[model samples]
Target: MIVELKNEQFYLCRHLLNRQAHLEPISVINQTNPGRVFVDDNTNPTSGMVWLGNNDGFIFFGNPHNEKFNQYIDPFIDQFLVEEAKKVDLDYMEAIGNSKDWNTTLEKVFKKRNHGNWNQRVYTLKNYEYLDKTEPNIELEYKIQKLDNRILTSVDLTNLDTLKENILESWSTIDDFCSKGIGFCIIVDNEIASYCYSNFVAGSVHCIAIETMEKYQGNKLAQKVAHTFVKECFIHKKLPYWDCMEDNDPSVAVAERLGFKSYFRYIGFDFSF
Candidate 1:
């Protein structure tokens, strides 16, 4: 009884919004991000799941006890999702459930292929007062720059390909990222050493993703770039969001140092094909 919903049918999933544990699903359902939604009932969906267009992952929302929907989960994964993942050359599937009940359902259904679990932490910046406003002193060899159009689209820019790939992992396209997302980077001798960007945006909230070159890890470049990105979010009246693996000590340290408070925790699962 499951069917893929068209763009117009996306609103039908609204009732299940309250169960969402992350902002990605909201961005997808709102049509502000690219993704596909499948539901048990298109007209009055009681349960549904979103397949992120970026091929990064999936999110499950709505009634966990819906018998019909639960029955379809297996085929949805073993068949439909498997074929779709092939297009992107993905060997595994990563997923998140909106609630504990949904998580339990996913655990049961994916039990055969489930490889591991990820403990994720979500952080919120309630007030700018917690922000460490101290600016990082960069060595003269390193310079910070905005991820502008030139940097986004320039083919010959040093490390631009890697940068674009990382961005597109979360964003649908470089053009879309340029239009809606914000980013900052640290450049060392014309090579990108570290960067941060809005990984997902739902309404006025933006979730941040950051990375630093292995050689540049100890320099606090992530914090510097994130500070710039978050400050930009504030100037534009947007809320900065931070999400990371629970065991990611460096990410946890940076977020906390930036004044973001731990808001919630969620579980993620990876299923091997």
Candidate 2:
């Protein structure tokens, strides 16, 4: 029951998870277009899986093993994982880890011996409910040419001067999705009030961060912008996934208003400084 890495098996693992939920396959193994190592047990194509990239090893995805498989092969898989870690120089800071059984291994692999400090959070779309009656405070609008408007431009984060001058800087990540994904702004007269962007991944779409200016707080512009983005995700046949720190209440509140539910909790650990 030795598990060996293979390419087709990796794709099957990804397909299985996508069928179950909107989770993003961890970036550790899937860093390259057609990545490196992929794992499989001889008897079961997906008894367990592992993926190794340039410098890091990842247990990218896995299917649960039966009692027989667990007794016969789980130990070998564990040993294989440790050996892979050593081979790749797996530094937690530089490496990404994702697995179905992360809760069990998090402490052994991620924790500082006695300190044991870790934080995790996850959120999902709860129920699909349409806004039958719009509230007065909730303002929703759409503009096809919003990106062309000069005032709606995102604050540049590349230049040192622009980065230092602005309290909020633009995200270059969403720039690539310009015409395809939704570009929205909650405006006040000619000024940009707040903004949000949505993007598609593996047939599903999710909203990234949305923010309102500090001076415009308490006006619910953040919620408005987020709701608008969520609606767009639905239209595109992509479910919106919300990810944020557990303590980020404001962002979580907006998700709740938009009918997002908590699906799984994920904690990130960085051991290498």
The local lDDT score (0 to 100) that residue 141 gets in candidate 1 is 83
Q: In candidate 1, what residue range of length 10 has the lowest lDDT sum?
A: 126-135
Compose the digit string of candidate 1's lDDT tens values, residues 136-189: 776788788899888776665688889888887777788888889888988987
Best model number under TM-score = 1
Clashing pairs in 2: 5-38, 5-39, 6-38, 124-261, 126-261
TM-score of each: 0.93, 0.55
What TM-score does structure 1 among the candidates reach? Answer: 0.93
Tell me model 2's lDDT, rounded to 2 decimals. 0.47
| Model 2 lDDT tens row, 1-273 | 555545544544544342343233432223222234444454345444344332322333455433333343335434564565666465343222354454455444334333233444555552355441332264444222233224334453123232122312222232434534455666554455667654223344453656676877787777766766666666666666676667788887776667677766655444432
